[model samples]
Target: MKKIIISVLLLGLIGGASAYYYAFVYMKNRKFDMVNAEAASVDASVLVKAYQENETSANASYLDKVLLISGTVSATDQTQMGERTLTLSSEDPFSGVMVTLDSAEAAAVNVNDQVKVKGFCKGYLSDVVVTNAIIVK
Candidate 1:
């Protein structure tokens, strides 16, 4: 009985350690540097138009991909969590490309600013969403 209990405890400890290492060490280090990544250069209006015309085709071209988008800022807001966001204007007044800016680039932009941003496309839901974005100079 004692041997069995000891073996079970040891196995449980090993499993817990493996899970911790995979969650913290491996996954934490696996984040890609978005600034240095290869991305498709696009205009904000053009991207919105593509999604508006055909979401399926647009997803094939842009979903989960990094994009460098250029446009005039239509709005800027800070979320409750203090993350800065920018909305870039498209041809359609009702819809725009929404970018969640990285902490480093958040302080340097404003509405009407013609800026370029790089981010990963997170698909569209009324507005096209881009996350982990940084302003491109």
Candidate 2:
């Protein structure tokens, strides 16, 4: 009985140590620095169309990946977080790609301007959301 209890305690200790290592040490050192990642360059219309046609396949290809997209700005909005969000016009009237940029940077862009943007895709919600966007051109 004592030997069984000791073995169980040893197993528990090993499991706890492994969990701590993964949850704290490993996770704390991980980075999601998408700004510098290699990205797939695409047109805004194509990206929006792909998502609208098949969301699952689109997510697999684009979600969490960095993208460089060129499109005409349809509208710009200032979010509660003070981030500037721009709606890129798509061929489909019902859908578009929403790019979030730093307010200071987005201010330099005006509605109706054609520009190239780089960002991390955050999947869709009526519109595809691309976060941490920077104007590439």
Candidate 3:
């Protein structure tokens, strides 16, 4: 009886440790390749317009989905943490598609440049937000 109890406790400890390592260590180190990911292609202006017209419908289609957006770069910004973001122009001057680039290579993009970016849509808040983006063109 004593041996059986000790064996069960040891198995439980091993199982717990394996679960923790897989969740934290393995998953954290895994990188998502956005460039190669399957994505819905869209124009930045159209994406913004869809969100502006009907947020619920837009969310149903775009929210949390990978998107490949093409547009003219209206602005670029670098956060204090060295994170780079760019805004794509839309028909509505007040709103645009905001994209957070995944790599430093995207920093080379300049305003007014026509470019393509792929990212995960994070829904709208005035601007359509896209995260983990990579400049495609």
**For residues 49-121, could you state the per-residue lDDT of candidate 1 as single tens digits?**
9999999999999999999999999999977888899999999999999999877674489789999999999
TM-score of 2: 0.73
TM-scores, each model vs. reference? 0.81, 0.73, 0.86
Give the lDDT ranking, best first: 1, 3, 2
The reply for model 3, stretches above 4 Å from the true place, is: 1-11, 104-107
Error of 3 at 29 (Å): 2.0
Which 10-residue window of candidate 1 scores lowest in summed lDDT? 101-110
C-alpha positional error of residue 103 in candidate 1 after TM-score superposition, expressed in Å? 2.5
Clashes of 2: 0
Candidate closest to the true structure, highest TM-score: 3
lDDT of each: 0.93, 0.89, 0.93
Candidate 3 lDDT by residue in tens digits, 23-127: 999899989877689999999999999999999999999999999999999999975678899999999999999998886454488899999999999999989
Q: What is the lDDT of candidate 1?
A: 0.93
lDDT of 2 by residue, 42-115 (tens): 99999999999999999999999899999999998878998998899999888899999844463388899999
lDDT of 2 at 46: 95
Q: What is the C-alpha RMSD of each candidate to the true structure, in Å?
A: 3.9, 4.6, 2.0
Q: Of models 1 and 2, which has the larger TM-score?
A: 1
Candidate 1: deviation at residue 2, Å? 26
